[model samples]
Target: MKKFFTILGILILVLVFVGTAVFLFNKSKEKPVVYETSSPFITDIIQKTVATGKVIPRKEVNVTSQVSGVVDQLFVDAGDTVAKGDIIAKISLAPNMIALNNAESQLESAKISLSNAERELERQKNLKAQRLVSESEYNKFLLDFELKKERVKSAENNLLLIREGSTLQSDLVSNIIKATSDGMILQIPNKEGAFIVESSTFGSGTTVATLADMNDMIFEGMVDEAEVGKIREGMELLLDIGALDSEPFQAELEYISPKGQQDQGTIKFQIRAAVKLQDQVFLRANYSANADIVLDKREQVLAINEGNLIFEEGAHFVDVETAPQQFERRQVETGLSDGINIEIVSGLVESDKIKQL
Candidate 1:
């Protein structure tokens, strides 16, 4: 009976050891690596570079003050359409006290001189009619009197300009700000009671309002120096506006800066493109956008995943599948790449299966 029990225990220990070995062996074995493969297909490949910037009007006219004064009233606000010569805002003249006092004094002196001249001219006319004075002498007095009267008028107009920033004979009121061009008012930078300086030769002065033609819009952006050389005027651009939800806007390159500007330690070149507006879509000024400038493009060409291409010393190769679960290295001529799919110029057919890295 003892022998029989010992034999049974040994048999149990042997079965436990066999089970542990089988479990470890199965866990150590690796599954076969099935490399996903993609076949070359006909598609459009466009190589482009992205530039960040904003969409704004092609020409922005700043409605500036013509005379220094305090804003009394605003006839238009932001987003209002305006025409040339339309009143944008009214400014109350903040006339200089010294200048006003001088103008008043000058006007009073001119009146006194005109009163004296009128009396002298009356006496001269009477003398000439009675033949008591020569005709030439009367003519001289008349000319002097006329000159005095003109001086009085000139003084009066000067005083009026100083007091009200306008004159009786002038049509343009200096205190009234008007639109310089036909466009929509983009912004009103000043409020009622805000004092602004007039635009003069010495300074640009305060901008009362910003006006722009919304119909003519452009995309102004900066491109990296490395990519600027690949672009030129008349190229096409696809604009992606962050504020709009519709399709990307189309634009044509118009201007490229001759110089580069440094931003955040990287040199960037400025570029401008005229945006082609679509119906029912309105693009506001300064809408942040990203532009995809196409440098090269290929239409309906054989392309494959760019990751499948392997680079050696100076040649490009791809692992083309010859049979199921088999691949061989083959040299391929490449073309435009849109950063994902690359154009397969030669050495590959539409039915060729390429390994995905």
Candidate 2:
């Protein structure tokens, strides 16, 4: 019985040793991973931030009425070019009958008093000349006559204002709204009879017309807060309008919002750039566009495909191809990158070959 038990133990130990040997043999035979490589070359490296917004004129005016009245006639239509003081619309006075009648009655009463004073003045003058009245009494009557004449003139002027909106004679037109500047009428919200309200502290009021100089076009976009600090005013910009195809338009950075706004949980800053549009190309206000403000640019920079770079433990590394199917690790000092290619400011010249994967 003891001999049989000892044989079973020996068999189990042999089987364990065979399994361990097979596992070690398979692990040692495993193949090394093959990596792809690419060589560094001279290329342009441009860095920019993309923003989505609309195309608007640099100078736009919302022509509004200063006085509230019924719109009688519209002289200019949309797309019409208007000069300063050009009549854009006309407002007919909605006469206030009660106020007009009250003013007229006051003027008539003042005139009647003026007539009585004039007669008294005449009588006093004649009496004084004939030595029939005292000089002090005649002087007092003359002063009252002159005061009554002034009061009648004031009453008449007030009557004219209530009836005609202005005291000027020669049948002056009422509320002829004119353009404040020379610009193209982009929009005429009020047609022939659209009533527009005057701009007040409460709001901008109803916009009568939208005028803009189409020649002065600009691109408005937003930059991510992460990149807003790197941009500044007067930086050259390249604008790629989706409607204009791949041909990028040129512009200059004009403004960067000082305050940050949260959008989709990501903070972003607003940026505006003045774009120089072609004379023939007409750009409407609020046209969507993408802008690239080049923070830094290089003509012919030593660059490599960004894919060739490898990251490990907070350090940047790359695989350089030494021979066919052979690669070695290389540390690179990089400069600005356009997100697709990386600029090699130092380390790894054009002669070095790099792996893409």
Candidate 3:
């Protein structure tokens, strides 16, 4: 019985030892989490927002006809430079036989009326010299003769204009469409024989061509209402034209619309920026571009990757690896952040290491 009790006691000790060994093996099998660390360095931090828009000229104009007629000639084509008062196109007057005949008849009648008024005035003057006519009668005859002459001149001028597009006394023609400013012809829709309708107050008629001053290009974009307040006139911007696939260009904010547009339950305001071109880059009208507005820029700032930061209890902190398997929670003073990286004002140095959790 003593031997059996001793054996039982040894069995109990062996069981306890096996249990402890199993527990330690299971604990050792657990996966250990690894951490990444980086050192803070002085860098440039720029906070920016992207906006999509197009490259437009500072001034663009659509040249249209003033009268409806067949296009007789196209004086300029696309890419041609034109000056103010330069004729862009000419329109042929359509058949309006009735109107033309009436104008002609009216002119002839006015000439006859003027001749009769002159003869009557001469007779009145002679009668007045012999004291046969009153002074008021002679004055009335002289006034009537002068008024009739003016009417004859006006009628003849109108008739000449209706027949030949212009009169000897007039400088303008209804059929000739001229440029209002010095610019390049961006488009010419109507060919030499295409018919065009004139623009009227009631409606916008056919557009003959588009004229634009390509020398001055502007970047037009929109900013969300939430970000519009952060943007203002005179702010510098970086522009990227997707089509060019080249380097970004520089621009300055020039205009911001006071009103906002409601789209998809979000408000956006229109903005215009003047981009000075280098080497006269060919920027077609409405070319797609992205404007990057730099809201903040800082140089030589101590910054770290934003992934290393931890926000807790209204304080920004980071895990610092002081030694092997040792880490400490440290609070840091931060300034401007550039989304990907944050500016660290204090509580960290370039030589110190940061653990990303």
Candidate 4:
């Protein structure tokens, strides 16, 4: 019985060893990896980088109140087209009590002074007409009376301006906020009765509305800091607005911020590109967009898939096909690369076949 058990265990060991040997031998005999071969082809290569941003009007004007007041009435809303000097909003003046009191007091004092001057002028005229006073003396009284009258008028205007936002001289254009340029209303941040701060030499005021020429739009976005050096102003850009998914818009690079901002563990630089408007297609302001900025371009050049090129010690080389299924290392000068295909500057021709790595 022990001999029978031993024989069975030996047979099992022999079967396992034979199976392992057969598996190992078959794996070793498997075919090696074979990459495809292709020759250089004539094609256009465009090297570009993408910047994510939004579509904005090239010129956006913020309409702010000249006086601290409440937005009493809004003349227009978003999407309303306005001409230059068109009223956008009306601001109700929030007059200061102290300033108003001072202006009124100043006006009253001027009125009293004017009355006294007029009475003195009457007496001086009588004396001059009867030849009791010299002509020079009468002229002095007349000049003083005129000056006092002018001061009274100025004080009255000043008082009126403090009480209301406008005087008699500016009643038509008073606290009515007008558009500085012709454009469509993009936004109305303040509603009726919303309190607002005045824009003064002291501080920036609250914006009542935002206006922009929708025809003159732009793509404002940011790019990674690593790709900024390859771009410059006036480069053509392909802008893809997230809102308008029909076709990509064309833009021209215009602004690149000198400073870089850190975001999500990476540095990005701001960029602005003017969008080229198309007919019958309206591009709303602040619509999100992505810009494809071309860094370089090669037209009708001999190029190959970038994967086939190998970089060694800063020099690029490709495997040129010597014969079927055989290749030889050949140094090649490269030019514009759009990441997928690269321009082969030298060491390869359109007819010379190259093997892929």
Candidate 5:
């Protein structure tokens, strides 16, 4: 009985040893999670928003045809500089057949009337020479002849104007299209054979070309309605043009639309900024660009990475490490943030280590 009890006691000891080893193995497998730490440093925080738009000239004029006709000649093309009153294109007048016929008929009728009056005047002159008619009656015949002569001349001139777009007594410029402003031609949509509409009281007409002063360029873009209110006129802007990567142009805000237009799902307000360009650098019209509007900025201020900040209620706070691997919740006063780093206004010193959340 004593031997059996000794064996039982040894087996119980073995089972107890196995349980202890299992517990030790599970305890060794557990791992602890750690976080990173950082400290505030002197940095620049530029808070800005980006607006996508295009670069365009400040003063642009569309050259349109004066008469409905086909394009006869184009003297200028895109990138050509022109002065005011310079001939940009010529139009071959497509005269209305019905109007031409009516004008011709009117001229013929006036000529017949003038011929009859001339005969009457000659007869009156003979009668007056014989004292067969009063001087007043002869004078009336002379006035009638003169009036009929003027009408014939007027109708002849009208017929010539309709057929040739110019009359012999006037300058030959009725079908000639001239530049109204001094600028560089940006576009010429009409070719030599393209039919163009005349800009009259009736229609806007076809745009022969678009001209503008490229020296005075502006960045035109739209901004979200939420961001438009924070911006005002005369604010500085930095433009990044996709075409010219090396040129960094600056601009001044000059216009902001009072109303908002719905685009996609958001309301946008159209804005324009005057681009200050260099003489050597040329900014072409309608180049896609992005405008970085600086809303606020801070130079060489105590700033921390925004990741270290924790928001509670409406205030901002951060987890500051007071001891080694030990952090405490501390309320911090923050300033401008460029989205990556936030300016630390108060609550922590340069030596305070901030833990990442």
Candidate 6:
């Protein structure tokens, strides 16, 4: 009975050992990898580069003061629409003390001269009446009196101009600021009573208001130096404005800067594009935007996911599925790529299945 029990226990131990070895062997084995497959499709592939920038008016005019003065009255505020020659603001002339004093003194002197000439003319008239003065002498005194009177008038006009920025005989009012072009007022930089310097050849005068034609807008942006070489004038661009929820705006590339500017560690080139407005869409100035410049485009071409392509030895290849769970390497000619999907110029047709990597 003892031998029988021992033999049974040994058999149980052997069975346990065999079961553990079988479980470990099964766990160590690796499962077969099933690669996902995809098929090429006919789609439009647009190769484009992105540029960061803002939307601004193509023609912006700074309404500056023509004479030094303080802003007395503003006719237009920011966002007001104005026509050419529209009054933007009124300035109260702050004439120079020296110039004002000089004008006053000149007027006083001219008045005094006129008074003496009048007295001399009256004496000459009396002498002529008594037949003591000759006709030529009387005529000379009359002319002198008239000349003195004219000098007084001229001095008075000069004083008026210096004090008020205008004269009775002049049509142009230097104290009134007007719009040079038809546009919307973008900003009113100066408040009422703010002092402004006059615009002159020596300096850029104070800008009282900023005006721009909102209808004529442009996309001003910068592109990296690497992609600048691929872009040119007259290309099409789609602008995405961050503030608007509408579709992208259409634009035409108009200007490309001849020089490059360095930002951070990368060089960037400036570019400008004319924006084509759509109905019922209003674009504000300086709206932050991004531009997608179309470099090349292929319509309705056979394309596959760019990740499915295998590039080796300066050539492009793809693994085309021959049967279920089987693939064969095939070479292909490529065209434009939009970074996500690539255009297959010549390769397997639409019916061919491609192995997705």
Which candidate tops lDDT?
6
Report the alpha-carbon TM-score of model 1 versus the true structure: 0.91
Cα lDDT of model 2 by residue, 1-357, tens digit: 999999999999998999899999998896977766567889888887777778898889998876566788888899999999899888765556887788889889999999999998998899999999999999999899889998888888777665555664435443677898999999987777666676678888778888988888888887888888888899998877777654678898889889989999999898888888876566677878878778888879899888777888876788877887787887878888888998887768778777777
lDDT of each: 0.92, 0.81, 0.88, 0.88, 0.90, 0.94
lDDT of 5 at 102: 96
Tens digits of per-residue lDDT, candidate 3, 1-357, equal: 999999999999999999999999998896987776778989999999888899989899988877777899888999999999999988896635787798889889999999999999999989999999899989999999999999888888877666667777767788899998999999998898898887899878899889999989999988888898898889999999988866788999989999999877888889999997878467777888999999999999999999789999899998888996578999999999988999999999888888865
In model 5, which regions exceed 4 Å deviation?
A: 1-37, 310-331, 347-353
Model 1 scores a C-alpha lDDT of 0.92
84-139: candidate 6 lDDT, tens digit per residue: 99999999999999999999999999999999999999999999999999999999
TM-score of each: 0.91, 0.76, 0.81, 0.76, 0.83, 0.92
User: Relative to the unseen true structure, what is the C-alpha lDDT of residue 256 in candidate 4, on a scale of 0 to 100?
Assistant: 98
Question: For model 5, what is the error of residue 141's alpha carbon versus the real structure, in angstroms, after optimal superposition?
Answer: 2.0
Ranking by lDDT: 6, 1, 5, 4, 3, 2
The candidate with the higher TM-score, 1 or 3, is 1
True-structure RMSD for candidate 1:
2.3
Error of 6 at 96 (Å): 2.4
> lDDT per residue, candidate 4, 186-291, as tens digits?
8898899999998889887999889988888778899999999999999999987776757888889999999999989999999998888888688887788879
Off by over 4 Å in 2: 1-37, 133-154, 169-174, 198-205, 312-317, 328-331, 346-353
Candidate order, TM-score descending: 6, 1, 5, 3, 2, 4
lDDT over C-alpha atoms for residue 309 of model 6:
96
